[model samples]
Target: MKIKKAFPPKIHNPETVNFNEPPAKLLERLYSSHMPRSYKKVVNGKEFFSKLDPNIAYQKCPKLKELLDKMLNLAKKSQSTAT
Candidate 1:
């Protein structure tokens, strides 16, 4: 005759198995609302016209320095307006 050994059943918390909530919900709970807004502005605004390199400006359009200067002035105006 052969003898068999029984193993214990696995136990898990019910909360760990469920993912009914959206991933954003977790982030929202963990961080303030301004966090997401600031993150987005930082990411998107990095591509804003002001950050472009002066060297590449010439290849992008004619009279690049003048164009870049105009863009910078406009950006400054907008920023001042916002505040």
Candidate 2:
């Protein structure tokens, strides 16, 4: 019988700094621009909180929420115009 070798799973340290990671401002912009609110028929309350990064999500930041709302509204308007 041939013996098979087992390899340990790769583990990544969450605390380790990753230079490849996008900056917080960019992340915030991306997150806000892409968050689904109108199409998903959801409000920017608890559901939004659940979908955001826990570390910065609970800060109750209004700018990010405003950006998201703006993006969602624009998408909805364009969608309506298309149809």
Candidate 3:
């Protein structure tokens, strides 16, 4: 007769699973709400198109940066654990 080894059951982490919102919607909202948009402006009798500056948004939105950092850290942790 052969003996079998049993493994422990998997644990569920609520932080890892989000059922309320999809990832695409979260990302879309993140960018749309926090990101700056380019627009046309008239300055000194000259018309110029302003370039979109990401720093402007970053400077204004600390929570956005925090969320992005947390997301990046989570992604890195998941990748490392997956392998």
Candidate 4:
């Protein structure tokens, strides 16, 4: 996973991120990540409060809710069919 570096290099420490807060634009721009750089303490040895909580993201960005719901539904369908 690539550490997303902004023009000034944003998160040097994951603990600095404000979780369950900030706006949609901020979420996408700063914290819209599947990479575990923030979450995996094995890599950084710091506790990072979640900014990518799906509920928070959905509340901030309705579009993300819709997209995630669709993806979840598709995954469920695929899993059921596989079974």
What would the TM-score be for candidate 2 when compared with the true structure? 0.32
Using all chains and alpha carbons, the TM-scores for the candidates as numbered come to 0.28, 0.32, 0.33, 0.38
**Error in Å for residue 34 of model 1:** 53
For model 1, residues 8-55, the per-residue Cα lDDT tens digits are 143233224237554334434433333444323344445444564657
Q: Which sections of candidate 2 miss by over 4 Å?
A: 1-59
Please tell me which predicted candidate would have the highest lDDT against the true structure: 4
RMSD (Cα, Å) for all candidates, in order, is 22.1, 17.7, 23.1, 12.5
Q: Which stretches of candidate 4 lie over 4 Å from their true place?
A: 1-51
For 1-83, candidate 2 gives per-residue lDDT tens digits of: 01011111432443334576533433344445554433232443445446658445323545666777799899999999999
Between the candidate structures 2 and 4, which one is better when assessed by TM-score? 4
Cα lDDT tens digits for candidate 4, 1-83 = 24334324543433245566543345344443645433334333222233335575565555677798899999999999999
lDDT of 1 at 25: 46
Clashes of 4: 0
Q: Which sequence of candidate numbers ranks them by TM-score, best first?
A: 4, 3, 2, 1
Task: List per-prediction Cα lDDT, in the order shown.
Answer: 0.47, 0.47, 0.46, 0.51
